[model samples]
Target: MASYRGAPYIAEQLQSILKELGANDEVVIVDDASPDNTIEVIRSITDPRIRLIESPQNRGYVRSFEAAVAASRGEYIFLSDQDDVWIPGRVAAMVVALESARVVASNFEMLGGGPRPWIPRLLPAWDRKPIANLLGVMIGYRAYYGCGMAFRRDMVPVFTPIPSYVHESHDLWLAICGNLSRSITHLEKSTLLRRLHDSNETPAGFRSLGRIIAARVMLARLILEARRRLKR
Candidate 1:
């Protein structure tokens, strides 16, 4: 997990994590040197399974995640967001999926103070039925949400030192790398309650014509770069 200025909810998130994790499970939290009290809050949690790594300085999400995964000892690593809530049974389900697939991702529901946001509400309706096929469609588009996915430790080397300039989305990069070695699977069940807050890297919105075009352009650039690297 990569954390920056998420002190307000880090404690709650950790509590939820501790509750869900089994005695054998291990968690590694990487603090990206938040200017806030995130580090202090994490230190207060006294669990042997939870190990905290404090970066000497601030690193962006991409680099921080790379560092965290590199330092992790778990055979299967689940990416986590500092603010989201993981529903019970998430780890068990993910473990089953990873046993046969290179990557596994689950569906998520967005929740907040009021009626569901327009984007979240429209997702299930706008997309086709039986979301299983959504995985194939994601190859040409970005589909994997970081917090909803997990992968085997053996695949870590493929993603480390993330190429400095892939205009493509982060999760897209993970899916692409996983595809090089094995197939990515999408679990039918919702494993997490993904919270939508102002601090999200990308805004939540339904797909519009402009947004579709932009996504295509970004995916194209990413594909070209991948091809170029393979050719070399």
Candidate 2:
């Protein structure tokens, strides 16, 4: 989990995570030099499985994720947003999907109210099969919402060398890298209540057109790089 100035909802998010996860499960929370009392909120949790790492300085989302993954002990690592609430059975469903695949992505519902008109405008309905269809599906949107993704720890080495330029969308880079050897499983169940507040890092609605195009272009570049590495 990566957090910055998320004190308002961080405690609730941590509690929900603890409730859903088993004792054996480990939750690593990384504070990206948040100016708020996010650290104090996390300290009150009182769970041994919950580990807090304070960054000496602020690192952006990409580097924060890198730091978290480096410190985690689980064979499977689940990426979480500091404000979202993971519904019951979310982790179990993800575990099932990851059984045969390296990357498993679950769906999430937009909370803080019902859907907005721009929601559909931004995310159109499309078929999920043939996998190749994802190339285009991935163009204008995030294929695996970062908050809902799960991956094997073994795959981290392959994902680490990814350039920081693509750090903002590291989940997309992971999906593209594992696309060939491991099928990207999309779980139909809504595992998380994704909060869309003013501080969200992801672009929403028609305002994200530029980011969409840039992400697609980056995806193409990563695909080519993957191919080259395979040839070697």
- Top TM-score prediction, candidate number: 2
TM-score of 1: 0.78
**lDDT of candidates 1 onward, in order:** 0.70, 0.75
Question: What tens digits encode model 2's per-residue C-alpha lDDT throughout 7-83?
Answer: 99988888888988887989998899998898998898899999899998997877888889889999989999999
Once fitted onto the true fold, the runs of candidate 2 whose alpha carbons sit more than 4 angstroms away are: 116-134, 207-213, 228-232
**Candidate 1: which stretches are off by over 4 Å?**
112-142, 166-168, 180-182, 203-218, 224-232
Best by lDDT: 2
- Taking the tens digit of each residue's C-alpha lDDT, what string does model 1 give over 1-232? 8898888877877887788887888778888889989988888888888888899898677777787888888788898888888888888888998998767767777655345333222132312232333334344333567788888876676666567764325676676655544456667777777777788754465678887777666655655554454344
TM-score: model 2 vs. ground truth = 0.86
Q: How much is 229 displaced in model 2, in angstroms?
A: 5.0
